[model samples]
Structure formats: C-alpha cells, structure tokens
Target: MNDVIIRTEGLQKHYVLGAETVRAVRGVDLTIHSGEFVAIMGPSGSGKSTFMNMIGCLDTPTAGKYWLDGQLVSTLSEDELARVRNQAIGFVFQTFNLLPRATALHNVELPLIYAGVGGKERRERATEKLRLVGLADRMDHKPPEMSGGQRQRVAVARALVNEPALLLADEPTGNLDSTTSEEIMVQLRALNEAGQTIVIVTHERDIAEVARRQVHLRDGLIERDFLNSTVETTV
Candidate 1:
C-alpha cells in the first residue's frame, strides 16, 4: 500500500500589494509518501517557499485543498492548523534556531514543553533525540559553545524530539560550509533510513542531490518530478 503522508490539489496562494497581485503558488498538486526523502528545488521567486508554507501548515492557501496524513488541513482554522503542525510536522530551518542561553538538551526539550509533556519524560525523550543526532556529549553545552555543524545537529534533534510524521527542512544547509553541509545531509540520510519522512527545500543542486527524489518548480508550477536513480544510497 502507498502511504501518502502529504497530498495537495489545486493548491494556490495569492497576495495583493496595492492592486498588484502576486500569485505565489498556483495550482500545485503534489503527493509525498511515507519514508521518502524528497527535495523541492527552485530559483528565487519560483514559489517553492510558498508551496512549502502551504504543505507545512504554516500558511493558508487562498484557494485549493491540502491533505496531511489524510486530514483535510486546507480549510482548517488557525488553531486547528497549529495543533496539526505541532503534532505532525517537524521543521528544520537554514538557521540553527536555538536559544542562546539554553543547553542543547533544554533546547531540544522546548517542543515537548509546548506539548505539555512531563519534565522527566521530556528530559528522557530529548536526551534520546540528541543522542540520535550524535550530540550525547554536548547535552549541557550551549549553542555558542558548539561548532556550526554541531549546532545544526542540535536543531535536528529538536525537530525530531516530537517524533513528527513529516519533517520539513527549509534550506537546511544554507548556512554551513561544504564539508558541514555534507555532514548534515549524511545525518538526514540516516534519519530517512530509519523511516522518517523528509521534504527539503533548497536551490542548491548538490544539496538536493542527497534526496532520492527531486521536484523542480518554476513560475509557481512543477517543472519536473522524478526519482534520482543515481542518488547516493549511502552516506
């Protein structure tokens, strides 16, 4: 059976700036199955970010439909979308959005805190996720104390601590150097191997190459959607 984790039909987002209409995303129909690692690639103004916002439940579409894990989220209220985002989506960003003063473990525990998880359980779960990202020894270290790669790993751990069904990474390697970028991609590959669904948005072909499938967008439409038969299967 094909377990579709994300499905969108006629998804569109438009905005008006003093009579100038901006069609950010126009009629994007997409499907992402469970455990698949996919990348959404596009140049600036190509609407990839708008498309990502729609699927990530961070923005509402002006028109169209969206289904996430079989739930119709397109028409959901803001509060409902918030609930779904917290329970089903994990977000990794270009910047390692960590609290400057908090330790790595505490930073990872933020999601659980928002979910109202108990202290002991939250600590244990955050610890496990940090360890999964190879940051076991840096639990007590603050973000400033870690290297660029290590801080991003901490961000990844925070994203996974909630055990979200879909992981949305937006320009995850944008800030890292070539070597550190590869390190992050390798970690993402391992997470996919362990059955986490991921969708990354990036303009860099090299970063997108790490994903098994690539979807190219242009002018708010999908230009190509194909499997990367030659994508490296191992880190």
Candidate 2:
C-alpha cells in the first residue's frame, strides 16, 4: 500500500547438489518501499546471499513471486530480466568489481555504454557521478593505481551512473578496513538520503546498523526485522 518498490511473496530458492536438494530461501515475504535503506544480515551459509541474488535480479527464485517496481519479475524472460536489471537496479559487490585495466571514468561509464549512450553524454554524466562521490579528481586513474577506498568510490559512482531505482550492495565493506568502510557507508547514506532505494547484504553488525532497517536471516529464514535505534541522521 505504501508504494512498494520491491515485494516478495513466499519466495523460495532451492539448489540440487549431488542428490541433495538444499533450500536456500524458504518462503520469504518482504516489501520495501521507495527511499528505504534496508540491510540483510546473516552469518555464513545463511540464505542471505541467495536472497540478495534473487532481489538483485542476478538469479531467479525456484518458486514464488517477486514484484519489482510493481512488475512480476518471475514472469519475465531472460532478455526481459536483463533489461529490467539494467533499467531498475544497480549493484555494488564486496570486491570492487571495477575493470582493473580501465580508468575510473571508463569503469563508471560501462553501464551507459551498454545502454548505448553516446560518447559525449556518457563522459559528461560519468564525470558528474564521480564528482558526486568525491572522485572527480581521480577519474583518469585506473583501479590498480588507486586506494581501496578510491576503488570502492568508483564502484559507487558506477552503481549510481544509471540513476537506477534500486541499489543492491553485497557486503560492500567486506574488503575495506573499518575507517574506509565507514567512509563508504557515509557515501551510501547520502545516496539514500537523495531518495535512492538501497538494500545491502552484510554480516557485520556495525555495518548493518548504519541502515535504517535491518532484516536478519538464519538457516534460510528471516529471524528478525527491526528498525535501527541509531538512525542515520547524517543522511
């Protein structure tokens, strides 16, 4: 009723491994509205990763319904799903998935290129996004030449370049130190404040606390869904 951006009803994912059918997500029901910042927290082997993949449109659920921006994702074909993924979602991974050989600007411009954006406009838009993330000066630098924080910043810039409706980050801070992780969190918080819907999957409590709402997963089921006490005022 609240203008849901993502809704899942009885979502389930199962994998068959050597005669064993393992249920990764067991009947998950969730609704996240626009402008919400949510965190999925769980220990290793939990279904959080599977859930994130499903939500991010990277993988399809074995069963159940997934409505993204009011459209039933499970009904879409592979090509249709790819289009929806490009138009509606942006993803940030734990490993800064930048093209090591490409410059920061180039990495950020990849999405636009895939969408067939022209050269001039792509460069201009990429520059603006990188600047928004405080990486304007590093646009020409390649990932290997930059620090971990800088690489992550570039990744964030890339995630935002398309102006997607949803940003899905998987353990975004897993590779960074505490200080650097906080810095990236600050950037993500700012994006959420700017009305970007975000769903982050993380195992670290401190990182999860940065979000306004936290959903805990255990043994392929949601154990808790609650609001954070220390609301992100800075965002």
Best lDDT goes to which candidate?
1
**Candidate 1 local lDDT, 79-119, one digit each (tens):** 99988888899999999899999999999999899889999
Off by over 4 Å in 2: 232-235
Error of 2 at 213 (Å): 0.1
lDDT of 2 by residue, 60-85 (tens): 99999999998999768888888888
In candidate 2 the C-alpha lDDT for residue 109 amounts to 96
Which runs in model 1 stand beyond 4 Å of their true positions? 233-235
Report per-prediction Cα RMSD to one decimal.
1.1, 1.5
* Clash count for each candidate, listed in order shown: 0, 0
